[model samples]
Target: MPAPHILSVFDQDMDRLQAQILSMGGLVEEAIRDAALALETRDDELAARVVEGDKKIDALEEDINTAVVRVLALRSPAAGDLRTVITVMKVAGDLERLGDYAKNLGKRVPILAQAHRVEGAAASIKRLAKSVRLMLKDALDGYARKDLDLVRDVLQRDVEVDQMTNALFREFLTHMMEDPRSITSCMHLLFISKNLERMGDHVTEICEQIIYLETGTRPEARPKGTSTAQVDVPYPGSRT
Candidate 1:
């Protein structure tokens, strides 16, 4: 262990980085929840708020990037210190992507609200969104606490999100086939489900960074339940 005085400043820098990541994660989680709720409730105002909130997340990501860069330049950090800075930057990027997906979902709410609601679509979407949000919370908490077990749990949750997306895909397909009138609503629902699944993927990416930060090597073969070919949803159910 280094002397108390020298260690204090280093600890402060690390703590600040971790705190910023958690702050960003919180905004992202809120965005996901609000976006899903807006879709479910058809609240255009709430959806608009989610869109506007994306800017704050983007600004926070920029702040994190700047701070990480400055730390790298100012301090010739040891191997562990270097890993923390790099991992924070990676986690920030993942969180920013999650915000973008939420923003995309929010922006589509008005279009979806105008269409006829498909039976059971909103409930399924909410379930998917809730799972992704929980995984995100776990990933953020694990990183902040440096808890590898929590990170492992987050990694496993991504598989469930993918499975949910695949099931949603099949359901929407059946709906569209049964009622051509339901195409518009089913299409939007498919996109929302895909967005939520992608959010879970971003959470898993953050988990990977946390794992790497704690242990020098990356985790072996991250869990995945859906393949690109199977999930390549074109026009909400096109087999092509």
Candidate 2:
């Protein structure tokens, strides 16, 4: 068995690791928010800024991953300690993916800015992005505070984002059919909506990681609350 002092040092290292994960999560959350804002305002400058910020989020993920590996290799963490390190690594990956989604959203902004705006599309997308951002924030808080209830709540909230995206998809289709000129802009907006929806998925995955971190076993898969049946609707430019 490790000596008491050594265990204390290990605990401290774990605390630092958790802090780093939270910090990285914060950057990801910011990226999501800014990307949505850029899309809403058609602000290419802000979009470009979000794109650049992704590098910071990526770097943080790499740093956290390295630290986790070091702890696993040097400390030889067993049981819960091992689980915590593994979970942190997984959570970092989720955060990194969220960053990528944000970057994707950013990349679409210039295209959207140049094209004709679809009435009401930007507002609805903003709402969708906000919901996903909140879920991500709660997921990060759940991880930091070790609040299982919060994690469970975040898991349920993703359905709202999915429903919003589905609605946006249907609405965009109508706009494209009514005015062919709007197709290009609406298509980009659809892509952005899909990115935000995917971010919600990754947020839920983070919640799952937290659940496993607290409980040794993964939680049972709950029925997905939202339906993607609307996705069957043909793309704007597709010809049958």
C-alpha lDDT (0 to 100) for residue 165 of candidate 1: 89
Supply the global lDDT for candidate 2.
0.87
Give the 10-residue window scoring lowest on summed lDDT in candidate 2: 222-231
lDDT of each: 0.87, 0.87
Alpha-carbon TM-score of each model against the true structure = 0.92, 0.93
lDDT of 1 at 42: 90
**Candidate 2 lDDT by residue in tens digits, 1-240:** 569977998899899998999899888888888988998898999999999999999999999988988988889999889988898899899999999999999999899888998888878988988899899898888887889999999888887888888888888878888899999998888888888888888999989888987887787885474565537666557884
lDDT of 1 by residue, 1-240 (tens): 556766677778878988888999999999999999998999999999999999999999999999888888766678888888888899899999999999999999999889877988888899999999999988888876778998998898789888988999988977887889899888888888878887887888888888878888889997688653465434545566
Candidate 2 off by > 4 Å: 226-230, 234-240
Which regions of candidate 1 fall more than 4 Å away from where they truly are? 1-6, 231-240
